[model samples]
Target chain A: MCRMCDWLGEGQIWYKNPKLHANRMYKLREPGRKPQESLRGNIVGSNLHEALEAKANGDLATFNRLIAEKNAADARKVGAQPIPLNEAIEVIKTLQMPVAAMMCICRKATRAEEETNLNEYSCLALGTGMFKWERWPERYRGGVEFLKPQDACDWLEYWDKRGMMHLIMEEGNDFLGGICNCDYPDCNPIRQRVDYGLDQQLVKGEYICEVDFKRCNGCGECLGRCHFNALKFEVTIDRPSIDPMVCFGCALCQTACNRGAINLVPRSAYPALRNVW
Target chain B: MNVVINPKITVDYERCTTPFDCKRCIRICPPAVFVVYDIESHRGYEVDKKQPGTYKMLPLYRDKCTGCMKCVEVCPVDALTVKMPEEMLT
Candidate 1:
């Protein structure tokens, strides 16, 4: 287990703890309470937008200042944790709550750019959030459907096949709220953290991917699967090289590799990346 | 709470076809202002069954719209009419 599983994991590897996420729907489902975003998700999205705008305007001073303030502010907000898709499914099975797939507003805003019948139902809202979702009519517009845990797993696996990484989010850092299956540029959190140089809300996964070069073929398939720009093709080795500091340990590369050459080691195992995140 | 901007987009339900097939407007709006609305039920695609006025595009995020008009340009049915916020025109 990595430091996250050690610190937040609370001896149960965080995601494995039922009590850490027990009756989330019960607590969040009070009548007429506003559907709210976790402070971190809200702040990071807006901060990244502003910072990017600043950079676009060639205002490096403003961009640097904004990023610094946002970073400090992020440390104080509630956490928006990033768990690998495989572990996220395990968390879903443990929670055993009703799951509903929702349209991804981030992708709708960023990548899809408009609306298309792309059939990309990439966001998963869990627990009471799914029930009281109508409280936020604007967000629940595309609609949501309940899924059996098994079906949810299958759906996520399908997205995985399509190269999406999953991250579980806690609304306001209290209630277990969503499972966002996302890719680069389209995902608000990933885009902010990766492109904006403002790393606050989203944390890296507990593990980092390591490549065993002996069995590896230099096919370069895993390079595109990485959203974090962690994977690179080493010209000398002619194989994929992973920069552990930049890796999120989502293991999309491992799954993408047909040769079984990649593996995830606990991030804590490396002194450099252990405290980097 | 989510914020909405000033946008007035109307769709010619009679001409536009999303329930049975086409969804160009829904696919093209950047702010996701357009959602599939069931006129007969006054609800959205949240329901399982498709109704008679099963799929007409409605402006759900009219406030979030930046008046890009990409949807207006992309709609094949020529069913969408968009009004920009007055301030945007200025």
Candidate 2:
């Protein structure tokens, strides 16, 4: 289990715990007091560039310090972990608050694609954060479209089918605030972790995918769906082998397999992968 | 020891108007180096993007820049410039 599960899991996976999803919609505060600061304020941006510069200059100390600082900041602020489609649906089903579909901030920042319509929004904002989205106009560019529980599940399924990974986002200390449907490069957390080594910002899921060689045809359909580089075509074996260490357990490949040759096994089932996250 | 020099990327905000509306640099860049954000909203409050000069685009990930000049070429207002230092040329 990861550190979050140890802290908030209550003997289970943390995201699966419903307590994190229960956030107070309105807090009583003194007059003239500002609202609780948004999660964006807690983000320590651009430190990765400085860390890279330090590494390039052979200043290992500075590089290590910057990375450690960024890790700490990320732990305190926003963080995400990949989840499979069924688990994401389970999360939505347990939500007591409204689910709103909002334009993906990462896509806007990285691709400059404005998702103004309800059909275009790729991220789901949870709990009280949706109520105060106006605080971050740049992120909530086209506003949000609140969806029913079934509609939200359909949205998740649509993105899952489109090859986007589902990631549960933690806004503050244990508050599950958003579900990001995105891919590598465009998704900030994934890009930061994969490219720049900001590992703490995005953690792996509790499960790992296992491929069934008996049912494999080596069609190479599942290889393209993996953003983690965990899946690769093996010519010698005539089928793709999944590297459990690199898999984030998004299950995009599992869904892509037309023959149902892939299955998700709990990470704890493998002794070596138990602590990999 | 080899000295590493990063490509310098500058966005002339004065010349670039409506960065939200005209995200040519953000869209064209292969590595997605540019990030268009509202500076005023850093403290967490709404800012009107319709208002002129509300949003500013920055090459936040300059390390990822390959010095391809794709952003520079695509920029309609000539607001972006990527220059590799003399050390890198050698």
The residue-level lDDT of candidate 1 at B76 comes to: 76
Model 2 ranges off by over 4 Å: A19-46, A52-60, A73-78, A128-138, B1-5, B42-52
Off by over 4 Å in 1: A1-8, A23-49, A113-119, B1-90
DockQ of each: 0.07, 0.34
lDDT tens readout by residue for model 1, A123-224: 788886677766665466666778899889888888888999888776644467788888876676786688566675687877889999898988888878
Q: Give fnat, all candidates.
A: 0.06, 0.40
| Candidate 2 residue-wise lDDT at A137 | 48
Output the worst ten-in-a-row residue range by lDDT, candidate 2 chain A: A20-29
Error of 2 at A113 (Å): 2.4
For TM-score, the strongest prediction is 2
Query: What local distance difference test score does each model get?
Result: 0.69, 0.80
Candidate 1 clash figure, as a count = 13
TM-score of decoy 2? 0.85
Q: Candidate 2, A93: how far from true, in Å?
A: 1.4
lDDT of 2 by residue, A50-116 (tens): 8877764557789779988888776654458899999999998876567999888888767767788
